[model samples]
Target chain A: MEYRKIKDEDEDGAGAGADIEGLRGKAFSSSAVSNMPPVERSKWKRKTIVTLALTVLTSSQAVLIVWSKRAGKYEYSVTTANFLVETLKCALSLAALARIWKNEGVTDDNRLSTTLDEVSVYPIPAALYLVKNLLQYYIFAYVDAPGYQILKNLNIISTGVLYRIILKKKLSEVQWAAFILLCAGCTTAQLNSRSDHVLQTPFQGWMMAIVMALLSGFAGVYTEAIIKKRPSRNINVQNFWLYVFGMAFNAVAIIIQDFDAVMNKGFFHGYSLITVLMILNHALSGIAVSMVMKYADNIVKVYSTSVAMLLTAVASVFLFGFHLSLAFFLGATVVSVSVYLHSVGKLQR
Target chain B: MEYRKIKDEDEDGAGAGADIEGLRGKAFSSSAVSNMPPVERSKWKRKTIVTLALTVLTSSQAVLIVWSKRAGKYEYSVTTANFLVETLKCALSLAALARIWKNEGVTDDNRLSTTLDEVSVYPIPAALYLVKNLLQYYIFAYVDAPGYQILKNLNIISTGVLYRIILKKKLSEVQWAAFILLCAGCTTAQLNSRSDHVLQTPFQGWMMAIVMALLSGFAGVYTEAIIKKRPSRNINVQNFWLYVFGMAFNAVAIIIQDFDAVMNKGFFHGYSLITVLMILNHALSGIAVSMVMKYADNIVKVYSTSVAMLLTAVASVFLFGFHLSLAFFLGATVVSVSVYLHSVGKLQR
Candidate 1:
């Protein structure tokens, strides 16, 4: 991570062909990266595969949870799902492997000192993101869907303001306007009546979504921090470490809360369909996190996330025979605009 | 834009800071750029302003349509919104003016032959995007929110494959894995629910979403083409020109088909807010396009778009009161991961 700052600035700064090449070569040549004993590489690879397996496993558990809830099996599904969830425990072992592997990369102990100094010291933001995701799920457990959606709008403002403060990023005029419009879109969606009932009584869900937004903001801030600390590190490495830590934390909590349930559930759920899907989903998440960490800025990562949601919003209406009022569409569009503007604002700044 | 190929490849390589500066200065001082008369500068500025206005005006009109549909005060809100959207247009114009007003230093503009001729030209991909957006909105008008949300996952696949074929950009293992996982996530979402209620006549909505996805893909390709053609233009200029062309096209379409519907509906439906928001979105889009085009690559823009969608998805769940089953949460997470990977993949390529 530690390197001399090459101060030359072109209009199209960095990421030119040469820069990308230089980075790759530097990583490959460093004794820190190169002297990885085969044992470490194998261990690292194994952990990545296990994490991928957990992702796929989760998909089936999700299906079971939904189907079981419909069949008056909430408690049963929770218990059953917990068993399926145990597959994620493998992620912990993977985490151990990663820590060991990363340690192995430290051949030049002196270099570690320099790298440490070069990297952002703040782990608070990353911690906040982990907390945020956990709370988001917690709220999801309690709150109805529409309510969760609306509260999410707060991120439009929260992240915008946070990026400004933490990343020292500036906002453009259009970005501010976009942010306001996004909020307005949320207001309009609130008025649409479709999501009204779902959001009403579950105050806890509402709180969680709010917390998630804030956490997401913090995650965003920390993501930038990590990227800035080691501009040349493979983003996959950054992402893997984050997941390794976050998943391990989550697995620990699950085990502590329901040790018996974790031990009892089947390794693979009924029909095998749901289990397969869960594993795939987990794998996807792993891949996406790694990629985002590698190439784009955190804000850009956020922007892509927004667009994907918009696409899903549009699709949900037709695929599920669910009602999508003009209000929903309008709100979604506004949110899209806001997200788009946020990115533009970054550029303008 | 073209310049003589660097005959001395060694000096032209990295570390040739002085060469870059000389080129920058030389390019700025070229008669092709600086020799323009005052009349030409004013003319170019006017055209740029007009182009900016056109994009803002058209996009505002589109947003106003959604707002009016929601507000039921179409005639009033449309106009107010239009006015609101125009504010951004004005800001962009002002920015351009400020840049020119502040242009006191040596400016070079040597007319150099461009090397775009060396690359293969493909217009089919570009034309495809135009048709895609129209189809997306058309589907949107009919589909339920949730249905549309699920189907949009196709975009990651679409963009990646297209890039592979058209740009010959290699995909990484993480990217391939992410795409597979994203597709799996979509499949899981579709499976988790009962399939009893397919849209008997889904042609209108489903087709539209499909088309929109296609168009978005095309737009992605078209932008890449522009970038490939002029590898050296400033990102701002490239983005500005893209918007200029896109806005011009959109504006003309509006003028020809539903100028009365757009303007009259906007005015009667609260024209000020709708107009202002639309203009703002357009201006932001323009600036974003320019920045991505100049500083980053088109894929960077793609990554941003994806991140924005991710944010929207998570936010929409609560905002719209959509049911957030385990599957939805997991799927969204997967989507987020896919976005990050895609961004990083592009960077690697």
Candidate 2:
């Protein structure tokens, strides 16, 4: 996902008469975007479809995780086993990509030079992701699925600020307003007046959510820099090193917190059909994000993720019978509108 | 008060490097502004100072009104008396402006016009304002002072929308985003989780606030059109007709709503030092608005009025012991920032 293509859409996309739906012709069809190769239309379509898939996978993961649990608690060492599954999934993706490159006779330095020097750069973001993923699970203890979905949008603010600081990306005034609106929306959503306990996200949940957003934002910007620093490197090769470090970090996490529990209960103690599906959803969503980035831009990813939030909320309402408060609904509406406005700003840039 | 001077300030005032503090020549001083006469520096300074004074006067009115009342109720009809006071104030202002014209030895048709044709246009806005002002008095029956002050910001949205509809003034995407944020902020402010009854605006209050905002927006935009349609017309001459019609409408309101009550208890039943001061504040604020408009722009008025909202809230806390909820504070903060963003958009335009 870090190795993404970025192309300027029509200014009309900024509501400046931008053909937001098509956004072709003189607007962005010209091959003038810095650092971006001319995009093939089919590739763009494929990436968009993949992003749509990512949306479904991401939205379903939380609901599925909740469904997999019994009495609102997970039977497994939720912390220990997910990393092992993710490790296997990453290895599989790398194997597939390697085979494809070999068939194409791509034995260049970028492909073969996956030395320790290059692999060494992956650990920091991997470590950040490790903490972030762990928090994702822990956060469930404090908030319901719908509430968690709303809180997840707080990541956008941290990501936007970090993107500006680390990448020196200039966001327009509209873009800044959009970011503020998104933050305010997420805050407003949290302020939902739910007298019931089932849908409320507590103060502890908010703290954990903020930490998670920060860690993820740092990891994301850092990873993006690494990917863009040497765009010639095969994305699969980079993912290989990143996954290796991620697995190593997750293994360390398992050792520190869930080691004894996993040892006694066995690695597959709480494994069930739904748990397997959730793990699959998680792994596939990760792959889908990378696939989308191979063609589409960050704005697409942002839009899809925001849509996923509303999808998760609606799903949670139906599947878990969660209550959607008026404030949450209005706040989410604002968040969605702000996301659109932010994308418009993205096109302007 | 409707008559005023108009000039473009520095684009920096829009927060766009617009010398928000001293936007001067080579910026707005180049005298290229369409329909605007070149301004003297001293005149601009005087107008801005008057604007500041207007802010102070506007903020104090609500506080003074609450102080003037006994047990949160007014002995006289609030609806009937304000218009009478406003009429007298407008008349005084018109008289002063007439003297200024006489001193300048100016008696052009633009300065002397008081025809039925000219005066007729004034009644429409006066009527709209009459209805709006009546609602202002009735709304207190539904909401408290602090909440009402927050809700008053709903006017921004209506004003923005109507400005576009009536004036065909193009708002940039950022300005549109800012407007949305302003609305979101106002709504969020209303959602404050104040346990006490004194700081909350109920559902009916929301409805009334919206209506007030719409009425004021229409009246404002329409009045601006009338004022700008003939740039050379002396503003004082125009204001005289507006005042005359406003007084007429205010009298009609008295007849329809409080004929028996006023006839029996007399118009001065609720008279107090504070009441007189409140009327003075209201009248002076109106004059100050026109005075500021002569040299400044709508953005300056907006900034002053929003600041006045905060001033009102703070003052309410000390004088009436109003509770300032966390949500209200956060919401007002967002609204303030959005106002700045919107002003920046204005500068861009």
Candidate 3:
């Protein structure tokens, strides 16, 4: 499925370029009637709404997932379950689309037919997604949430590289600089001045985090390229196929992990309400992340996630009775500046 | 969005009839090439694959969710988290669609424009989804997994009623009989011959289960109506709006439940790796349920779920040392018969 989308990209790139130009021209013409102010305002408004939604959803996902695990004190390995959950998430998207089609009386048989035809195009990305999620679960085993937050920023750089190579989209020098500043900001913001806690984290965890970051970068870029390949296709239609493959991939993962145990004992032996809630949180965050990727770029996703981490830290001060250090404030400032620069760079480009 | 779909159904019924007729003619003309053999064989093959997939995914979801809760031993209320999870599911669907658009070079500018224009349509269904999910969490709290599974069969009847009234779709007499048999089978199968377990469940749990069934029925029918109304719209585009509203609705639910603790303490506390796994499980189930709904209908979804419950029961015999009563086998026989009858009826129709 992934290969098909990439192939589609190669075949369709010229058409897409022409379409983008046409869209730009349309935007220019529309400026005469609407002027830039209202349109820009609405565009910004939409972006803000999307960004904030992503931030809140993702942060909540991280927090709730961690908290649920703590509350459950479960001893089971999470990798297989994670794969299963990823698969389920895809199924849910497909279901949602079906529901929409049934209720809305919108008949585009062509689109539906095309969607099914394209089902063969999603397996690669879905497999990549499964691997990335599995690695993420492993990373949680080693790194504290705060450390994980900081290390994940490495994806921004990886995404930049992937973006250039895969999409052949050039980043301006300023944009490149912004990427560096974004990384620096995230590192500063998540810096733990507390020596004891810092030393407690295993070196293996850090290594895992870096690898996870690299994986995330590749996955994010790959997903973006797939979406870009068929920019005009119904997003939901494409998602349906992507998720179909994802579910299949995860099923294999679960079966391979321990077929006998999963089949005989059941996949959810020691689960609780908290565990269910945690799964829910992860699913939501997945959606939020995908949305950010769709409307913006991987860089924007990274920035929004960073902002979420910042919010989480501030939130911790009151919720957990943690005291903020001076270094924390300094990091927050630098990160904020970097975010502003990145946004400005995006606008200028 | 729900209302729009419903309205569209009313408006487009004639057009749909014509389209169906047109399609039938096409099918008739194509029949000369191979008669029924190849076509029938392929159709049956597809159906078998889909049904098997649905059964496996749904069953795993049920077992894992129940097991996760049991393992956690946590006593916290799941209402707020349920809302958050529900919201997140929608967001995830949206994100998936967006990612697809980004990857696939399909650019329908009008589709994007129309998607935004239709944003106001999703809140009603989104809210309905929220309510149904919340009720489900409560049902889980009161009812044990096995009991929850059996009682949920009530939705089969409710769905039939709702389908007739909302979607104006009629069930064959055989289909209705199948529904009745399905309910009876589920009850008989779950009936505890063991006195100790039999007396333990509260009446309130039964009542909650009933309500959850009704809600499920309504939500399922309503969603089907919405989707049927807009068969032509991009499922992902529509999903994006639906999720946007769903997130908003969940945000309200979270705030109304307890604004201060959620906001100050943040949503995640006492979380661990296991909790994350459990969340992943729920998300996967959600997807599976959706997929079943999309590919088949509510009847198929109910049947698949029932099969999952039976699998879970059998698994418990091996994993949890539970004994399967003779009555369970008898009930299973009846349910299987009903499923076969329903499938035949659908084919005849």
Candidate 4:
């Protein structure tokens, strides 16, 4: 039964590229309406600029972070960069929200019937992710960093299993083999690390990190599954808006707490600037994501963006003049290759 | 055009359950054999027992780890349980390799196609997954534990964006809202932490964790996309065989490594034991995944299994006597709720 599925899929794979391209052309036809109202056309034009600006800005920042890390500047620089990037992320997310807000209730050109309803609407996946993050933060406060990192890698393995089980997707020999390699690489990196001995107290941070990774996988897988069930919507834009919404929630929560301390904090002392930037960044990312979804496949988009994320991470290590270990480099390389291969596979077939 | 696709999909979605189920049943009946050779039948029975045993043991071990962590005994105890679980994982993986070796080319009882060569071959995704794992291990060695954990959660957000871009799937409003909820939870978790204001050095571990999570998403999305294109050959055991193949590679690698250190490394040390367990874990997981694919939808399976993973993770934290901050707890709760809601939605119309 399964064997036949694979054969059919392979046969289809050859022609799929063309099919997808055709789908894209048709998908965008509605959006490409001629003689649109000036207001709508202007909105579209502005959005186009916003999207271009974000892609360029993000791409540049990603590159700069990578370069700076290699240059090895001040000790605080990495942290600063992280903060800046995160702030930028927040802003991009907000921008995405703005785009969504502008076109709220606009139905998708292709909408599918879903099981979603007001009563059944729930936020478990997202909530679980947050819980996982909070747990990690608490754990980090108590544990060693490297220990946590090792555990974090388990997410891939876990997700690989989950993907097969949940998605009912058949993995090729290469896909299966690659995941093993990834696990092997992670183990190797850990074994080579200095702290192989028992910990006085297990690093809470490390535990949290692992939990976070797992939660992330869960959320991601669920999102993918659910998204597939719906009609093709403005995914990129929606993602950004979601971020914006999340940020707004965070900001509001912060406001109810030690607002003064945060306002007078060292890095983001100016609320107005950070707030505005955060919104803009989030919104822009949404648009960019939407554009990517509109044009490419999920694997391709993810793989490409992950490369950017990976570079950003590597830059953090060197740019901040942080101490580097051999195992760390090995692990990073392993991860980079895995992401690249996965993305490439998606693109090819 | 987009609208029509949505309509088509909706029509398909509503009737697909029956269509697919009916198709599967028909395929099964056509391929169903009345006179199985005694040799093959016996072999299958044995294989099923072995698979079941391995799954039960590993799952129990996983559960045990959670329970021990919740009980807050010596950290070593939990580690030991985890180690056993890891060994089981290794053994399971190896066992899978054995299965593939023994069963390769013997397509029987329900393959979509009888020949593996009929499918398009691709190794890029597998290689990419391998790289992802290596990177994860590298980062894990350097970062604090909790920090690593939180970073991993970023998988959810990344997966959402990637799915939209790569799969051209649409996300519903609720799922989109859930994404926002997750981000908020993570941000709150970050803010709620009482860690030092200034970093002494860059958190390499945390970065690595995030990198691993991102890689997993990339690999996972690609795997799903590819598998969707290639239907499974029916034997309901392709995933099993794939794992078997993957395990073969892993076992060879493990055996080639110097066993002296691993075998004599104090408690739970034994290269042979580790090797065995790893094979078993991988093998069962692979086959089990195929079973899931055969019986259920992708998102539903993922969503359900994720619940189990999260519950186990949370259980581990409490069992281990890890500290739980209020805000962190709240965030985690929200994330869990969001995921739950999403999963529940899948079960609906």
TM-score of each: 0.37, 0.75, 0.41, 0.35
Candidate 3 residue lDDT tens string, B12-115: 01000011112222344446324647866465444445556656655554455455555753332243444544555666766776777777745662144554
Candidate 4: docking tier: incorrect
Instruction: Considering only chain B, report the TM-score of each candidate against the true chain B.
Output: 0.57, 0.75, 0.71, 0.54
lDDT of 4 at A166: 70
User: What lDDT, from 0 to 1, does candidate 4 have?
Assistant: 0.40
Candidate 2 residues A1-349, lDDT tens each?
Answer: 1100010010001001111222332244444323344465544455546766767776776566557553343566655555755586578667877786768766653364566777778798777776666566677778765566456556777777877888797788767776676666655655644422422467888789888877877776677676666666776766666667767777887787678988998877866676567566666666665554444434445555655655677788898898665455546756765766665666665
Q: List, residue by residue over A115-138, the lDDT tens digit for candidate 3.
A: 444555567666665576556556
Error of 2 at A76 (Å): 2.8
Query: Each model's DockQ?
Result: 0.03, 0.15, 0.01, 0.02
For each candidate in turn, the interface RMSD (Å) is 14.0, 6.3, 29.7, 16.4
Model 1 per-residue lDDT tens digits across residues B183-249 = 4344333323432123333776656655565556555655666655656443333333333434444
Which is the winner by TM-score between candidate 1 and candidate 4?
A: 1
TM-score of 1: 0.37
Off by over 4 Å in 3: A1-46, A69-72, A80-84, A103-110, A115-117, A132-150, A193-211, A258-265, B1-349
Candidate 1 positional error at B219, Å: 1.8
By lDDT, rank the candidates, best first.
2, 3, 1, 4
Output the lDDT of residue A299, model 3.
Answer: 59
Q: Tell me the lDDT of model 2 at A229.
A: 60
The lDDT for every candidate, in the order shown, is 0.43, 0.60, 0.53, 0.40
Error of 3 at A321 (Å): 1.9
